[model samples]
Target: MPLSAASRPGGAGLDFARVLMEVPHGRLSGTLLVTGDPGGRFHLENGVILEVTSPGSPGVETLLLRSGRVTETDWASAVRSGAAGWRVGAELVARELVGSAELQLICAMAALDGALAMGMGRIDRVALDPEPPATCFAAPEGIEPEWLSRESERRIRALGGQPVSPFRDRLSRTDAGTRLLDDGIAGERRDILQRANGRRSSRDIAFLLGRGLYAVTVEASRLLHEGLVDVAPPALGAADGPAPAPEYGRNPEPTGQPGRTEEASRLPRRRPGTSGITGVLPLRPVSGPWRPPTALTAEDRRFGSAQ
Candidate 1:
């Protein structure tokens, strides 16, 4: 089937924490597409997350290629070898590029980080696109949504108010720290310094270096705090106040208005005897003799009250 779009919101500032929670609450199985400044897809099976893809998170391919675990030729060849799109992980495992446990772990991390990316940005609308992507290195059993959402929310709160967001702010080396930055910089910090050219963001750097987006953002924040990097203006999907709610139990605000009177609001009560029946239950025609329908007596009322 075609990937049709649905559930587009008509209002602004739509928070999709409710929809994200609904997947687990209803035990939904499909690809939940979140669309906004930096939205992405959450692929779930039987309400557990199989994989997730977001601009703020690096996938298995990026992690494998950019980290020099595999070359482009091998990656492309393996992709061609997958006939049904789900065996790429097995293919890599067979070739000894990555262990099965390592692949599952990477898929789980990608899902968690993707969810964090969704919460970090503004979510305009959420819709279920039943069709998942053709090819993705998904975890075999998948991760539970409750655990995934909570952990992602924890990471987001820890990253609160940082100068550099994964997809929002770009950074550049500070002129004042030019000599200091190049003096003894090495490892991840040095790699980030090389990419922080006032154009690319933490998301870009993560894709380029096969590192996690949140880690790159935190390091960039450290650089900014230490007077080594200067951040550019806020990008399209900068983090805002009122972080998304993590739990699925969150209730939406009530939109119904109350009536002025009890009678006005109440439905017509038409239970058993409200129809003015003149006989007791099993009110049927007599077989042998015609008889008048007996009216309710005081004893019957007393018996009813006793019951």
Candidate 2:
């Protein structure tokens, strides 16, 4: 493992950072459509982050309904009563289902978490959308773009690639993992362990359970380190590569079957004394802000194309 985009000046993370900062510096308003797995969009209002949407993270509706804070019937009713096109938050507040301040906080958290989820994956290309849709919930006094970029990076890099991505890594239970569940664990990790049944990614678990993607991924990483859970390989077509065997979660009972399921752990693991957890590597100290060379070329603008 070497320094990644998070640490490398020329990485896509830095490119996005530049874009985020530059757009806000000019006090621009638009949505940045970032392309990648479970790609996301950042809606900016005069350079302030109004909302962010991503498939890798739970949205406001998931946080409301899936968490049991709001019932399906009530939510549907509110949606029907929504005004200003998509302002469901206002309806919820007016109906006394949720508080105005609380709704605002939830909107802010969802947007920031969505940005975090986007940071955990590759960003291929970013295009600006001038007419971004108004969300059902909007964060009051929206987040500043510079702080958004900095904080998002701080959160993502703090994990240091120890966590598997909800977008890329699908989890399954190991024999040990099954035992952990069978022994009757409790709380969020327990729920996460129960759902790591060889099919759901962390995103799926978050949506199903109304948990934040970051929280679920962190717990999954802990389970992975404990040998209680493992990453299932990608589902490739027949022509993709050498036919990889299908990975399945095992029951607590051990069968006389000769092949062990541990071999099915497809994701890479770190070797001792190496930064092999993922792309995370120690960043060299920076003396100043990074700038393109004076002789900027078309190639200089290419963000992580070689990666």
Candidate 3:
């Protein structure tokens, strides 16, 4: 549906297209609208009204993966084969799976370009205006649940070229916390606390820290408790981002022991059998070679790897 400028508020431009979705029973194509985004959420009133977002540096693009378009297998394959993550988002475009123009749309959506409403389907009998997207879309009348879940996730990925629900929250510091603190937070912990500079979530940090998630959590919590770190609220979309290096030597003091290795005590102590476990201990002690704390202040990092 090509809506005139007058039909929309503030003369916002509108563009509509019909894309065929490859589904099991048969090909399913829905009418998608591309209206100027006042809010940057490349939102489309498609099957169930969806919002698409990206991480890291927000790009300019609109890669719509509708619920009725692809399959679960397609999404997993793209991810497992190292295809659909943010690093690969641009690659997918480069490979021509998505168009340059589409990329612009996706970017606009991510940035919340405008306050607008986009309709889906050949007709506009049912429309949503600035409505919160439906999390789990109901089948079109008679569609099966099995098919619904698969198609829903697929459509979700297709629209955003990303996963439906976020794998983790934005402010979380799972693994990266371990690494950045590995050499033992070189200076006062308070300096390394902001999330605005693009700190990675625990998942992203895990890859960098070369440590398990549990270990990272312990380290992050220790930093938080000792007033060295602060958990930033979740970003609007993806979690990982670069953070500005903090100043050091303002209060250089390694007050904690061996960098406060509290991995064993991070978990909450719970009663046995309460949560279905028969006989579970709250925590198990660890015995290993003690590694000295590694420095991690802005000055330490700038003064070469040796701090």
Candidate 4:
């Protein structure tokens, strides 16, 4: 069947962790589609994760190209062959481009990386498709969603120790005298820092760097906690422009008496059934104020009450 974006039944809440657990426990087989920042799909068979794909991370093909293991032409040829019924990984192995074990490792790593990225941000929406696209290749073994959830939890805890959640915040270089490169930063970390323009969010940096969002987010969080970077102020909305200067020398319309009495400043009279505490308390009818009893009744004394 063609891919269709279906909403959750009964308008259920979106919780990545809970979904992961439930899918595996129920031994369900389907593609769990998640939509949001770093949105992705988890392909599972009987609760075992067969594959994962996310916009927030590089795929196996990109990884191979970036690692210089294969040329673009070679990748294209392999893909064409795979689409023609030969498994891409098998084709590459047959062509002596990579070993069987190596291909398996790469596929597993890519799946895990994508899953990690998917777990990093809020899952805004989700759907399950009983039928997923048929592929020429199959994973040597499936990954347990339970394990993925545990690893995700560990990653979250590690990130929680930092000052910021990079996936959710934009970061920019700090003016601190300490330099990132001077501290032996090189390769990916250096590349990430160079792209930290205070305007791009971590997801943007990931796409720019052609790396996994989770990896970039974790590194950005570390850089922030180490004071090598700072969180950028939130961008203002179109309606958030500066307020017009007050009309000087013109008498402003009286919102109230010239000098509103202190009594007027007291909390707005609670709606008949609302509490005096504006938001801290629930909106319920206020009973009479508390008062001490003049004397405890015999019944109260029996219950060990004090007068």
Candidate 5:
């Protein structure tokens, strides 16, 4: 569904990375709902990403099932029991089926994976669902938005030299491919290669493997470069053409200006107390008297001297 201007609040031009930058810096507490192609909801607390859920990718439940950590019956039971309160994690923990730490780790991975998948595609609209202060189950503590953006950029850079497009390219193993034993391919890549049948797109392979699109694409790209596989452009009646190149997390192009870096020269300086928006909660200023003490006080010094 298309998001209206009122729902987006941050304006239509804001992409995923930009939205992420704005939320954390503004310390906004709510769910940032992204719609269209690679849609998802980013749950934030004090501007930190607690969890991210995307319809385009496999969620925690699917990941757990595909990993063989939980049986389908067990997952179904948990979901049925926890549906009223949305406490599947709590249910599993209470039943001792999965450890709290393991659950947290899995959930964190799922959220990051979903976010990464969303990052690879276009973000059509962004809406804020203002939620009250509350605790989250299996939520990562204090995950910075900038860190996510940087990680996304790094992943994109890693795929910089890839010849096959992640969106449109369909891959098939080369006829020279042999059994898995001698070729040295193992783990996720092996699994991905096994499923590549010239019919499925990278997104399909990701869903089949319960892996992230970015990961599958990167691996497939490597395989293509190695001549182990071949890529075909989108067939007729395919989904929309390849999305525009990512905008927000990419490195800024040089303007050819002297004595200035692209980032330093082009980006606008964020004004203090700007709120980062006209509605909802305003950004909390970093400057304050509560800054950490740099050194021991006179009393502590005197006490140490006496000792």
Candidate 6:
């Protein structure tokens, strides 16, 4: 299917694409508003697909596909019919498209990209109707509504302030550290890293992975040490004050030991020269035998007379 392009009333160029996405929240339901113009592509996971609806915000002249409005097949057919168009690379998974997974994966990627782009101020906030499926709002001073969700707005703010790919060099510089994104690093790493967004502690990462605090501390430290990530200090004067110091390297050992030395100290000690016994029994020396005879003399004489 061809990728669609349009021009919004406000002089901003719009581009739209279709993708299948999988979100942690749920399965694929319908099409979503993808991006303004020249924004990064979004993807959720391998099995998800998403269809981009707006390359250019068409204003009232064109129809914007609202979230949760259509299915993957619906979007696919629309694209083939020229009513809608696919984004670049959307065609790759055309054969394997699974409604929920592919679409949601696409949504996740788009969500991340949208969040990042939103950070750059490419898009503005608009009034969104509050409901189970939240709405988003962003608009320039006097234009028609540009909707963004409260959550989406926050994500954009958090992601937009940082350098893209904080760990790219570290991931590439060494074999031991490089995730290489081999098979791609999109799963847990991406999930945790995105959530980290500078607010989470290394201990949090440790807990999340069920790993030792030291392990998580090292991993996070590696991310920072390699310059692939950074910690986000709390906003100035927020009532929360300073974020409490991270209790790093504090996760207890899996075997219930606080640390190795303490467990080793609890083991029973060996006593010197106690090989035969555990030293629970005392050793005694053997004595040579000696005979006693006075009480038996009378009985011995009688025995000899009878013989």
All models, RMSD in angstroms = 24.3, 11.9, 20.8, 20.9, 15.1, 33.8
Judged by lDDT relative to the true structure, which candidate is superior, 3 or 6?
A: 6
- Index of the highest-lDDT prediction: 2
Q: 71-146 in candidate 2: lDDT tens per residue? A: 8888888877636358777778888898866676677667757777666655545667777547667665565566
Worst 10 residues of 1 by lDDT: 261-270
Against the true structure, candidate 2 reaches a TM-score of 0.68
What lDDT would each prediction earn against the true structure? Answer: 0.58, 0.60, 0.27, 0.53, 0.54, 0.28
Worst 10 residues of 3 by lDDT: 113-122
* Global CA lDDT computed for model 5: 0.54
Name the regions of candidate 4 deviating beyond 4 angstroms: 1-19, 22-27, 36-38, 82-87, 135-138, 175-185, 238-307
**RMSD of candidate 5 to true structure, Å:** 15.1
Instruction: List, residue by residue over 206-280, the lDDT tens digit for candidate 4.
Output: 555545555676667667767777887654431111111112122222345422211111111111111111112
Residues 25-132 of candidate 3: C-alpha lDDT, one tens digit per residue:
232223223322111222333332233322211222211232112234443354455544433444445456545444433433322211111210011222223443
TM-score of each: 0.67, 0.68, 0.20, 0.60, 0.66, 0.25
Residue 67, candidate 5: Cα error in Å is 1.5
Segments of candidate 5 deviating more than 4 angstroms: 1-16, 82-84, 132-142, 178-186, 237-307
lDDT for position 135 in model 1: 39
Cα shift from native, residue 291, model 6 (Å): 99
